[model samples]
Target: MKIAIIGAGGVGGYFGAKLVKAGHDVHFIARGEHLKAIQNNGLVVKSILGDFRVANLRATEKITEIDQPDLIILGVKAWQIKEIREDIRKVLHKDTVILPLQNGVLAADELSEKIDKRNVLGGLCRIISKIESPGVIHHIGVTPTIVFGELDKSITERISGIDRIFKSAGIESTISEDIEADVWRKFILICVSGLLAVSETTYGELRETKETRQLMIGLLNEIFLLSKKAGVKIESDFVGKAVAFIDTFPPSSTSSLTRDVWDQKPSEIEYQNGSVVKMGEKHGIETPINKFVYSCILPRELKARGLR
Candidate 1:
């Protein structure tokens, strides 16, 4: 199948390179040094599974250069969505499926408004990865999983074909029965960890301190309640399972958002924790813990961008 990867950052870069290595026709839409590197050499993926390079890869900054792809994996940051919507539309065929592997819960709906509902699929990605450098993608975790399904919950040949391709590339891809719920579950995990990591000093600091740990759990509970109120059918013990998962991680484990905030790079906080705050307000739910975390991170965000 012809595949196009938008925003060839860590998520797209790693998965797209793997698909290319698996002998699939993959085109990466990227810009700046990362695009130059992929065009000059290839997309490099350094992961715990293995390290490899796809030398015969196709890459371009504009979508018009590539043919219509069967699947377009949208991996851009949440902030870049509005800017790239039309650009992304240019590369899709009538039957092309756009799977957004973004962090927030609103991307699928937002994209659906621009593109045909049938052409957009809801996706949730579970991986600890980042752009280690301009051309390098570093995946830190063992499981690199992706879950996607049709917006209307219909199973189609295209979804099956995409699933086969992903599995061929050694990725664990599932066709979720309820993609929206899956997306929210992932958001809860990421936002809780992200806010705590940034608000405190590090993951170790949050996990080691009793007060911070309780606060982290409380923040997660608030988001979970908001999700329930939003009508998402999340598991009852979701928070308990999440806390246990965090305990298994190395004490030094931190979210990518925390790293971005610390490095003064742009972050997706407005979509993560800020999303919870906005949704809670809409539902008349009091999210004091999440609100507190959001407030704490705002100063750092302002400071990082010299807005303070």
Candidate 2:
């Protein structure tokens, strides 16, 4: 398969490197020092499962330079989907499948709005990894796994083919009956842990405090309500299930949002918590907790991007 990875960060770099090593044709669309590093040395993945490299890769900042791809995996920040869709569309053929592993529920919908819906797939990734340095990605925790399916949740040949491609690369994957709910399941985990962790200091801090724990639950409940109103097929008692899931994380651990807020880098706040808030208003549901979290973090996020 000819694959194009847009944003060779942790998720893209790790998956793309593995695919390239599996002998599939992989081109990475990257920029700056990271692109130079991949061009000169290779894309290095220091994974807990294993370590490998893909050297002398076909990487470029321009999309038109590459051939038509069979699949395009989007690993950019959630806020970037709209901005990058046009460039991505330029490289698409009739059969190109766009898989967005962004940390949000609206990724497929957002892409479907701009690009052809036939080319879009609902997807989510479960991986705790990041670009540790130029050309280097570190997979620290959680075995990397990808879960994806069609918007209508059909088990088509394309889904089977993609699953086989992932399996061939030794990557774990699942074809979900409802990819949107799967996306929301991951979103709940992030928003609750992420918002509370950002509001407090650490997972330890929130876990230790009953008040903060309740706050996290409050935020999650609002998300649950919004999910139901939006017609997502999530369980009614998901808040309880999500709390148990959050407990599995290490106490000292923080979410990508918490780290981004601390580092003052751009984050997926607008896509995750902010999306909940907007959806809440649209559905006439109260989301005080999400609103509070979004209000507290928006300033820093804007400043980080120089929008302030």
TM of each candidate vs. truth: 0.94, 0.94
Report the alpha-carbon TM-score of model 1 versus the true structure.
0.94
Candidate 2: segments with Cα more than 4 A from true spot: none
Question: Residue 101's C-alpha lDDT in candidate 1?
Answer: 92
Model 2, C-alpha of 227: deviation from truth (Å)? 0.8
**Predicted candidate 1 versus true structure: per-residue lDDT over 1-308, tens digit per residue:** 78999888888998888888888888999899988988888867888888887896789898778788888998888767777877768867899889999998989877876777888899989877888887889887748899999877788888898899999988899999888889988888888656655555566678678888888898889989999999999999999988887766555667778887777777788889888999999999899887877777777777866888
Show pairs that collide, candidate 2.
none
lDDT of 2 by residue, 140-242 (tens): 7777899999999888999899999999999999999998899888887788645654566677678678888888888888888888988989988888998
Error of 2 at 96 (Å): 0.8
| Candidate 1 lDDT for residue 290 | 79
